[model samples]
Target: MFRDWFKKDEKNNSRDIPDGLWIKCPQCSQIIYSKDWNENYKVCIKCGYHDQLTAWERIDLLIDYGTFKEIYKNVAPVDILGFTDTKPYTQRLKEAQEATGLKDSILAGQGEVNGIPIYIMVMDFRFIGGSMGSVVGEKVVRVVERAIVDKFPVVSVIASGGARMQEGLFSLYQMAKTSAAIGRLSKAKIPYINILTHPSTAGVLASFGSLGDVIIAEPGALIGFTGPRVIEQTIKQKLPEGFQKSEFLLEHGMIDMVVERKKLKSVLYSILNHLWRKVW
Candidate 1:
């Protein structure tokens, strides 16, 4: 019966299996149908593990259909330091751009979430581990500034390793820059909802990522200023089990909630509706 259904469905009629027809969950190694995976918002139905989302995918998942208007599209990165390890930084940037179809690791824009207007920023981990460079910082700052001006509630979805190393001090400086931006929004009494996805860490976590008025993290997401391995080495002691994971963070009072991907949109809407109305 399943074979018959696959044959009759026009979308799967081709002799060659469609791209992304099956995805294996990294956590549980369950073979999942692509449609089912998307229907569940890229979460594993078997192990309940949430997969990472690209910047565009995150936007689509959260934003109301046909409502997103992107900001700062022209703000591309510049190679200021002429840095090179094995290859030049510019070459790396080109390759990342081609692969992700984005000028940078982060995307910022305005969109509606369940009829509530919002300004949103999302990071693509595929792009240099979603590094915060000069462009990324500037874009985030601009997005927050726009939110303050328009009085739109803000949402920043973070999935990053840290600040870009190629840009050197330029990247590190973004921490202060973005932090200042978020601070301004705080002064304006704007609600900033931060959703930390898998592996939000390093300078990104130390800065604006942790400054959200309401911080929500996905289940099992790694949230910390440093990697567990580094911490273990530095402290010369074995770390606690599940250290830096979202649930652990919540237990330690580091974050407000550990929301599942399926419930994230509704949870965000509920928070916005409840808090925003009180402020407005």
Candidate 2:
């Protein structure tokens, strides 16, 4: 009877636990309940690490309900180079699309922030590291152009690893294209606010991402033109502690402020309220 009891106890103890119920914070290594983490905008309660959000999640967090009308929805990437590494570029694109439900890395649209109309573009890091490719560039240019025509402010949330390597020169060309479009927006005197997230680096940072009228980054985000390891190797010196983080950038005047995720919407609304007169 004791053997049977032990067997029953073991069976009860071995009952299945659902996956993804808890998440370990990358910054603090604290295991957090998934529900609580999500409720707090995926920010770690202990360490305050701002976790990456999906493009749709960002839209829901920032935009008023039912106010986002996505433009350039049909603009998808094409494998013009037939590039192949471990896998074909087309296959990689297909997988990314399937996995993220995004046609490309970016989602460009018109949205309302506290009833204030604006044009917004949000990049999803899940799609090939949010790499800027031909489609991404085209969509950016088109969105800015639309904002110019509509006489509205433009807000860009940048989260990219860099230019997409698969597109080769085509990807690099987008830096110029996006930067030139932003120049036109500036010429029109429209307010262009850039929100840089973690891993905003390389070509994207060198171009339009850096050309914002007001640049804001989240706390602890990595924002720089090059990775610290490569830079240290090239310079033959150790880099500063917290180098390339948003707070570091702010101290050096590279960014305007480091805002928390929960307060971003109100902050953006305040910016729009202050800048709305320029649009009129």
Candidate 3:
């Protein structure tokens, strides 16, 4: 009986498990069960490295259950420039849309956080690197305008690679447009908080991403205008370790705080509560 039981255990150990049941942590290289990783908000258990989240996942993480009402769902990107690279801009948009199930890279809406009403915008890096185009800029402007009218605070979670190059000048123009809208929000004295995520860079970083009254970044997030490699090549000097990371930026006085992914909702709620109380 003992011999039979040992053989059965060996057979079970040799059985093939389906793919995606395990995840490899990029930072620590430790294999983790997918269930545990998801339960931890996709953060690495061994090293605490934060993985990128889809816009909907982020919304579910931050917004109170059943309280998120998406706006501007109909606003889709247009190939105004008739732009084409290796592939046509339209085709790329279609593929990204099909893959991510989003009209654009951004998801903007009104949601309640811990029973506090707020307007929130989240960018999904999966969609064309979360590049900002005309629709994204328009949605951002509209969301902030709505917040101004509703007298509610605004929160933006930025995960971007910068302006959409296919749109050419139209993409770059969003920087100005979004900055001006945030200016209006600032003038209104309403609280605007920005949560910078991994790969928050380029045009997005230069504009409204940096205009938040309180800017927060996730641990280990890449936050910068230009990438470190490009800067090093241009300057012909090696960059410092951890350059432009969330922790580095915080140490350099660039951002307000570096919060863990698991604590983001609570931190946001606490900050919003304090800031909202001052507004009233």
Which prediction has the highest TM-score against the true structure? 2
* lDDT score at residue 243, model 2, on the 0-100 scale: 99
Model 2 / residue 24 / CA error / Å: 1.0
Model 2 poorest ten-residue lDDT run: 4-13
Q: In order, how many clashes per candidate?
A: 0, 0, 0
TM-score, candidate 1, is 0.93
Runs of candidate 2 exceeding 4 Å displacement: 1-8
Candidate 2 root-mean-square deviation in Å: 1.4
Candidate order by lDDT, highest to lowest? 3, 2, 1
Q: Give each model's whole-structure lDDT.
A: 0.93, 0.94, 0.96
TM-scores for all predictions: 0.93, 0.97, 0.95
The lDDT of model 3 is 0.96
Cα lDDT of model 1 overall? 0.93
